[model samples]
Target: MSHTSTAQKKLLSRVRRIKGQASALETSLEGEPKCISVLQQIAAIKGAVNGLMREVLEDHLRAHLGAPDISQTQRDEEIENVILILKSYLK
Candidate 1:
């Protein structure tokens, strides 16, 4: 099975948790929440998103770039793609 298929359940769980965090953040924003509380929620959401991104990036690197069966050209292409994405993500 593909790496994505193997991790689908875990990834989905993380996504669901992030969704819940977003919903809670929205609700908190709608009420008289303290500034610190709102900031903490925002931080939590950011951390969760970063964690998910890291997981997917690592998987992509391993599955697409590190696979021995693929050609060097293919690996170079994957590296370029990763670089482009990282540049955009960092921005």
Candidate 2:
């Protein structure tokens, strides 16, 4: 199995929590929630997403880049892919 498969359950749990947070934010907006409450929910969702991204990115680095068995060319390709993704994500 792949490395991500090993952590699939944890990842899915995080995604579910994010979905719930989004739903809560939607509900709050539908009602008359305070501005602070909306901001807090948005921040919570963003933090959760960033945490999830960090976890997957770390796993990818370990599995794809840190593996000694892979060729240098393969490692270089993976590094370039990671850099491209990070640039797009940051933007």
Write one digit per residue (lDDT tens) for candidate 2, span 1-91. Answer: 3988999999999999999999999999999999999999999999999999999999999999999899999999999999999999999
Tell me the TM-score of each prediction against the true structure.
Answer: 0.95, 0.96
Q: Which ten residues in a row have the lowest lDDT in candidate 2?
A: 1-10
Error of 1 at 58 (Å): 0.7
lDDT of 1: 0.95
Clashing pairs in 2: none
Off by over 4 Å in 2: none
User: Which one wins on TM-score?
Assistant: 2
Q: State, as a TM-score between 0 and 1, how close model 2 is to the true structure.
A: 0.96
Q: Could you tell me which residue pairs clash in candidate 1? A: none
lDDT of 2 at 61: 96
- lDDT per model vs. reference: 0.95, 0.96
Structural RMSD, model 2 = 1.0
Tens-place lDDT per residue, model 1, 1-91, is 3887899999999999999999999999999999999999999999999999999999999889989999989899989999999999999
Candidate with the greatest lDDT versus the true structure: 2
53 in model 2: Cα distance from truth in Å? 0.3
